[model samples]
Target: MSSDELTGASEKKGFSTRKAFIFAAIGSAVGLGNIWRFPYVAYEGGGGAFVIPYLVALLFAGIPLLFLDYAMGHRYRGSAPLAFRRVSRYGEWFGWWQVLITVVIGIYYPAIIAWAIRYTGFSIDKAWGDDPEKFLFGSFLQAAKTPGPTFDVVPGVLVPMIIVWTITLGVLAMGVQGGIGRTAVIFIPVLVIAFGALVVVALTLPGATTGLNALFTPEWGALGDPSVWVSAFGQIFFSLSVGFGIMITYASYVGRKTDLTGSGSVVAFSNSGFELFAGIGVFAVLGFLATNTGQPVGEVVADGIGLAFVAFPAILNEAPAGVLLGLLFFGSLVVAGLTSLISVVEVGISAIRDKTGVGRVAGTMILGLPMAVVSCVLLGTTGGVFVLDTMDNFINSFGILFVAALSMLALAWVWKRLPGLAEHVNAHSSIKLLGWWRWLVALVVPAVLLVMLVLELRKNLAEPYEGYPAELLGVFGWGIVIAIPFLAMLLSLLPWQRGVDLEDPGSDQLDHADRTDEGSLR
Candidate 1:
């Protein structure tokens, strides 16, 4: 019997419309990474030349894998755990591994959002004042004197973190369509508009063209470097938000008739488009900073937290209407971060709901509240920034990439589901997946990911990441990475709760039943 039949058809939940799914999916894809990470990677990789490899990776690896994720979830009509369980009992463990990585992400992700919130207020008066780096590390984060573990909580960070949790949990409590969907509909448009305005303002700045030129100037020689191609692939993989369970979970809620290929393309391109837009705004501001400071753009340009908090704030200190510009920039971060946070939290929420048959409220409270508490307590501390940075590195490098590569291997080789999934995607999607696409997903994507995994592992084994103490990196970084898959396997051994089945819930039967029910209503 289908999960709908087993749990009662009335209980299944989904987005109210196709647009809701698209908006929410795009919201998940566009996050702080787009705003901060991509521009620097593009600049460093090969300037304008990076776009060549980025587009290639997107076509060969990113979109194909995205299609696989969407088809799996939409076909099974369940989140990652349940969706993979429908494939095979062992496959369920992989899904749980993804969930655990997302859980780790959930714990610290909000803390950064909380930082963005505090910075938003600071933007009002250029409060970071003079030495922006000192203000961020010393005044705001109150970063630990040493890299070793410490529990000193920064009140400035904790207070906003509470508010962040309250808002996220409240929205999630409203159920998928009413809460997540509605928020996406409202926030995405505002995010786009807000950033659009920032771009307009940025272009009018004196150094805008200089920044644009720096961004787009192609260094033809850089293309030949294998590392540059690897960087491009890595950027696309991370930027697209694949290999994590977010796409799979979001796709699970999509309507049966939704076009998987078309939707995946929209989400992928929308994410890339935003990255390009953000790069323009970011580099434009950087150009102004370099011009004013009598430094080159390369010296002023940075990425990750440094770019968002340090470099940008320093520029704002010198810009006209600096305070107003600050608000728009930080406000954009909060909106982008919140949307991604919702999706990350939803991965765990949907997994719990699938496993135990709990409603949204119960699931959100059970998982969300604890995560919020942990986020507040741990990230609230002085050493919190160090810890957050460590966790993020390990999770992305080992956690996400490992799960993604494993997933492709399982679907293509073990289950042999790729051909069928391609058929499912092509049935509804305007863009059809042909024979070669299967080889790309099966061979090309996994090979590239494996290379990335091996290279990262070799690097980490050689030395502690970023020169942090080995003990700290071992516990928070490598420890968590190693633990996820083992824990997932352990969890898989537990007997599934009653009403959840181990067998595939036949899609044909579910579709027929839905049609019959609709006919009766007519």
Candidate 2:
């Protein structure tokens, strides 16, 4: 039985078409990272030359993992946990690991969205006035002087967080097609237009060419650096929303007989394209800021929060027609973030629906309301800046990379499911494959992830992460990541509800581990 069958068959939900699935997947992929992360990562990695390693990672690591996820969720014809259960009873914990990672992300992800929503309004009035860093850290966030937990709610952050959750969970309650699919179809194009217009406006600024040159100038030596390659892979993996449960859950909604590989290819390219476009727009604005202020592009370039919140506001304060630029830029962030947040929340909701055999709306409320409340309580306080920063770093480094690598290694070697998955993809996909994909998933991807993991651990060990207090890092950083898998395991031990599907969806009802000898791994 499916989630559909677990309830009434007639009440089951999915994207109405492959096109809808593609849009939803793209919406998931083209997110805040594309807007704020890619530019600086690209410029730092090797400027124009970063494209080579990025493309290599995309073809080798990014798209391959995406197809691996599609095969798991679509072929097993279930939610991440349900599908992995079909793979092998032992494999269910891995799915829960992925789902829990999303739960962790879902808790804090909307706070950033809330910030963006508030900033969109701030754009109209040049709200940050003089010092954006001071304004953001002091006035808007009311950040504590040091890193520690606090419960004093910042009303500014809380209201917008409530608003963000209301819109997000509200859409989710309408079921997959009515809500997720439609929002993607509508929001993605609007995102393109909004950001595209921003790009045009950014390019028209006086120093736009200077920023483009800085971004496109090839530092040939960067290609030789091992870390550059790693950054390329990291950006692709993060920007594509692969490895995490987002792609897997979204792929589960795609209709049968759809060309899964073809869809993956489209999504992969569209995501890359959007980010590159974003890099242009972002760097272009940075260039204007640099030239206008008589600074080098390198001096002006920043990444992540610093780029989005700090530097961008400074540009808006000085740039020509600064108000319009602020609207387009911040509005784009709002639109982009909401789409990705929906998918992050969906992964946990889908798993809950599968576990309890609840209908979509009920399952959404069961999990969604609490997640919203926690987001408000934790991230809408003075200490939120400290906790959110630590959690995001620890989770992205230790949490996501750890689960992705463990799941891939387990599914490929222990469960011996790659051949079956490849067969499933080849059956339904227009793009056929040989055995190399199996080898890539089995060996190469995990190797890259583990290497990245080791590097992160070493760097964190070398110094306290971002100079936060040891106790804070221990609780919110190391402690939470340490807790996730143990929690997932305990959750797995709880029996799935009676009506949820537990049988294999493949043609023959055989344990995937038993199929290891099948035709040389397909």
Candidate 3:
């Protein structure tokens, strides 16, 4: 809560306008998960009826957490670690935990994007041929025999991966407004148009109605299942990218006068709308696949890598004007994935610049080169798929949720900074954050996160994740998830540069709110 942040002043770069910030935020939110993860999670939860809990989760947990991030970043006017560091001495650990989580995500996120890049080209010839599954694992990936580290490079993956890193780092080096903001302005609309066209084409296919029915046909009884509710909440949390440092870092780039609450609402709704749109397109295609193959929709549907690389490619081969369908779908993935990856990688670059007071290029060089090397070395190898799959699962389940809950507790009950944060947001927000908003952010969201964590722990402990070997799970999945926090703590011990102001702002009214019976910011 520096006076500069209070006055809407910035020492670092920022978005030129509110529209850019909104576009940038939406770009981060609408990602690969929207395309592959949400539809399956929705169908599994309760088909169309899953929208009930999903919307509830969005309103109650997702957006609340989103605003919480916004307040912290916009109020403190720094990267995640610097922002939390401004809150109090003990709070920086949570910030670093988020930063480290982004690091892990950045390491592997681009490989998926690269896959989409190559596949977009592969669509032209139906290069995967009849056996898409085998081609994915055995041919394109050259997947290793076992899930462990391997230096053996796969040219198909490596080349595209290098290109992905180049494109991402290039954009990041151009500064916030010129690179991130402008790219979102340019690309988000393109993504919408391309994916929208794909949906239209998908609807025109035979059995599209059957697919729509299978997708939208709600199981009324699923609402009674606690697991379905958990699925809905999980989908909302992950889909919004709320808990992680992404929103926090992104929000810091926004102008202080911006209507953060309004922007947040816009980003949240746009993300969910895209997800639902994606579900429609995916199911329509799946229905066509079922009709063509003489199988049920259930058998044709999949999630994660299987949905994009295997099922879609198989579906593409049999459809009329198959090349256009493949291009639209896979090309959409590339667009969606690039925007998300840039956001992910930007978290690290911004953190570096804030700590060292480096130029954008210097920060990009420091973070980008090493990140790209590791991304190419580890993720571009034959064993990359195993690492990507395991890391993506554990990190999303544990890394993000774990830190999010802790952050809420630390801000609400520990430091007692929620009032000040709320005040900061309310000052500029078009939609006021009231007492209920505080309660939702401080208590309800944390409780939901804890429940999700417990359920995830129970399920993972019951069986090896995806039935991968124990050692692989231990090293890649559990090991990485567990290691991030401890590593974050170690990083927090390092000193900030002279340029970083660690001082707290004047009187945050730490106890005045409770004493005066002020439960919310006006």
CA lDDT of every candidate:
0.85, 0.86, 0.85
How far is each candidate from the true structure, as Cα RMSD in Å? Answer: 3.3, 4.8, 5.2
Ranking, TM-score, top scorer first: 1, 2, 3
State residue 313's C-alpha deviation in candidate 2, in Å.
Answer: 0.7
In candidate 1, position 518 carries an lDDT of 13
- Badly placed stretches (over 4 Å) of model 2 are 1-12, 507-522
Summarize candidate 3's per-residue lDDT along 319-376 as a digit string, tens digits: 9968998999999999999999889888887777666667778888898999899889
lDDT of 2 at 278: 96
Cα lDDT, model 1, residue 346: 90
lDDT tens string, model 2, 145-220?
8887799899999999999999999998887888999999999999999999999999999999999999999998
Tens-digit lDDT string for candidate 1 (189-284)? 999999998988888888888888999999888999988888889988988878888888888776666888898999999999999999999999
**Which model scores highest in lDDT?**
2
Error of 2 at 15 (Å): 0.7
| Ordering by lDDT | 2, 3, 1
